[model samples]
Target: MRAMTYDTYGGVEVLSETRIPVPKVGPGEVLVRVRCASVNPVDWKIMAGGLDGLMDVVYPVVPGWDVAGTVEYVGIDTPEFTAGDEVVAYARKDYVHGGTFAEFVTVPVRALAPKPASLTWQQAAGLPLAGLTAYQLLTRLDTGKEDTVLVHGAAGGVGSLGVQIARALGARVIGTASARNHDRLRELGCEPVEYGDGLAERVRALAPDGVTVVADFVGGVLDTTRAVLAEGGRHASIADHTVLGAGGQWMWVRPVGADLAELGRLADAGQLTVTVAKTFPLAELAAAFDLSREGHTAGKIVLEV
Candidate 1:
């Protein structure tokens, strides 16, 4: 199978197209013929050694976690799916030896969910990781209709979905984004606030009582979160583990079939959607990683397998 591999932690230049044996399906795993895979910041972060101390890695690492594809084979005892089933998965394994940027990727059945019928392969591939992150954070916070939610980086991959999911849950959303994305935020039913030195003041102008839930997808806004939060408000961050010291949860997204399924259901029901900012062919994984590293794309980048 053809896959992109990096022999060591470095920049996008380290990624190279190579042919390797297809991964064996371990017990409770499935072999997916990948149609598309999404590029996330974590993918590049791992490639550049930012997460070196936190997780073990094997050389010639295949780096991607989000996949939308068809099941080509099922592992022993994996009865939840059969060959030829369409699926999407947040295929993060315990280690980083193999991944979805390939002709085929192995997925644990527990991380597999049917792709949303309303989404294209590119969109489905984009949904698993970012969509699940937003869904999990909001659920963990128990954000609900009565609450007013403030979403930091609300036009980002996870933050954009956070805005939509909060709206679906009936929360009043105030989203912080660049002025360029303010209209997009409004389309998703959020009160758009320009993110800058006066972000707290902008959010305050929208919600005089302050927000009840804060979901920060971008880091370094802890004080701003404090400034705009109402008493008893809950907050969390996916980017900053330091949040744990300040009464907020620092989250790493988990690969859960149930959670992905819920997100898929939301997409199929028109309650949620995934946006693909750009795409590259499997061999051009380096270029895709470059785009992700640019850090300004408002939507997910993808690799077509």
Candidate 2:
């Protein structure tokens, strides 16, 4: 099986396309013949050793987590899915290796969900991680009717989804983005605000009493969150851990099949959608990573296997 692997952490220069043995299916896991995969910020961060102290790195590491494909074989004792099932997964394991950017990859059943029929392979591949982050953050905040929510980085991958999910759940969303993305955010049901020196004021102008929840997808916005949060409001950050120091939740998305299935259901029901900014062949994983590193893609950057 050909896959993207890096023996040592560094830049795109370290990434290489090579043939490695197809990973074997183990109990409670399934082998997926990859159709497509999506790139996330964490992929490049892991490649650069930014997560060295946290996630253990295995040499010759394969570098992706989100995938949509067909199940070729199911391991013994895994009864949830079988051969020929179309599925999607956030395929992160306890350690890094045997990832989704390959012709074939093994996936634990816990992270697998039936692919939404309404989405294309690239769209399904794009949904898992970002959607999970957005949905889980809102869930942790207990977002609902009559609440006002602020989303930082509102036009980026996770933030865009956060805005949509908030609106779907009956909250009025205020999203922070550049002037160029304001119109796009409004179409997703958010009132867009430009991020910078006076973000709090802009957000407050929309919700004078301040928002009830702040979802920080972009880091370095603790002050903005503070200024625009209502008294006793909740806040969470995927990028900034200092949120914990400031009495907010600092979260890393987990691979929950049930949670992921909910997203799939929403997509199939036409209540949710995913945006694909770019797609590259599996051999061009380096270019895909480069695009993600640029940090300005409106939606997901995917790899077609």
* Cα-based TM-score, every candidate: 0.98, 0.98
- Give per-residue CA lDDT, model 2, range 4-92, as digits (tens): 99999899999999999999899999999999999998998999999899888777899999999999999999999989999999999
Model 2 vs truth, CA RMSD: 0.9
**Mind giving the per-residue lDDT tens digits that candidate 1 earns over 1-305?**
99999998889889899999998989999999999999999999999898889889998899999999999999899889999999999999998889899899999999999989999999999999999999999999999989999999999999999999999999999888899998888989988888778888888888889999999999999999999899999999998888899889999899999999999898988999988999999998888888887899989999999
Model 1 off-target regions past 4 Å?
none
Candidate 2 residues lying further than 4 Å off, grouped into runs, are: none
Q: lDDT of each model, Cα atoms only?
A: 0.93, 0.93
Predicted structure 2, TM vs. truth? 0.98
> How well does model 2 score by local distance difference test?
0.93
Among residues 3 or more apart in sequence or in different chains, the pairs in candidate 1 whose N, CA or C atoms overlap within 3 Å are none
